[model samples]
Target: MSDSDKAFFTRASELIELANKQNQNKEVKTGEISASFMYAVARYNAWFGSTSFETKEQMQTHKQEMMEYYVERYKEMLEANMNDYIEHFDHYRKTQK
Candidate 1:
């Protein structure tokens, strides 16, 4: 991975660790936690994109374009992570103990 990739993963790892901590609370369902995380991300992305544009009209005009960009990027990352987990299932399970 390039330095940028390393930095990205480092930040991602920190967020995942926070989520894992929440998972440790037996009362919390993983699906609910995942949904909340996704919602928060979507909200933040909308805010970030809004700030990038000078006007609400401009932001509204590019809303679909921005959403598509994020969705595609998320799909790519999700697929990559799913494949990685599938490939290292045993190793991850061992470490989880």
Candidate 2:
């Protein structure tokens, strides 16, 4: 992988590691954890996008485009991951050390 891609994956892996730690607490269901994760991503993305534009009008104009972009990217990622899991169900299901 290119250095940029490696760095991107490294950051993503760190977040996943943090989420896995949170999952170790049995009181929190996986669905709840994932929902919270998605909420944080949405919240952060909104705030991050807002910082780029100086006016509410400009942000409003681009909001739909921004939402569409994120939704499409998410759908693609989810499908890819789902396929990967389905293809490697046995390996993925096995407990990792």
Candidate 3:
């Protein structure tokens, strides 16, 4: 992996750690929200780095298109993951109850 890839992974790991900490503290909602945001941002950055384009103008256009795509996809992923996370937390709560 490139340096950028390593950096992305490091950041993503840190975010996951933060989420785990939140969950351990019984802050399920906050943890999920934070994780979703961090995941979206990290995913976007990773995708942006992976794309290739020649010429400044082409790169700029691609970036714009990618930004839009990432925004929509990230939102969807965030919602789905957040729902899953919340559901998992609820299950834990029920077990404890």
Candidate of highest TM-score: 2
Off by over 4 Å in 1: none
Model 2: runs farther than 4 Å from truth? none
Indicate whether candidate 1 or candidate 3 has the larger TM-score: 1
Model 3 lowest lDDT segment of ten: 46-55
Q: Give the CA lDDT, 0 to 100, for residue 75 in model 1.
A: 100
What is the per-residue lDDT of model 2 for residues 37-93, given as tens digits with 9 covering 90 to 100? 999999989999899899999999999999998899899999999999999888988
Go through the candidates in order and give each one's C-alpha lDDT.
Answer: 0.95, 0.93, 0.74
RMSD of each: 1.3, 1.3, 7.3
lDDT of 1 by residue, 1-97 (tens): 8999999989999999999999999999999899989999999999999999899999999999999999999999999999999999999989988
* Per-structure clash totals for the candidates: 0, 0, 0
In candidate 2, how many clashes are counted? 0
Lowest lDDT 10-residue stretch of candidate 2: 88-97
| Model 3 TM | 0.45
Which residue pairs in candidate 1 collide? Answer: none
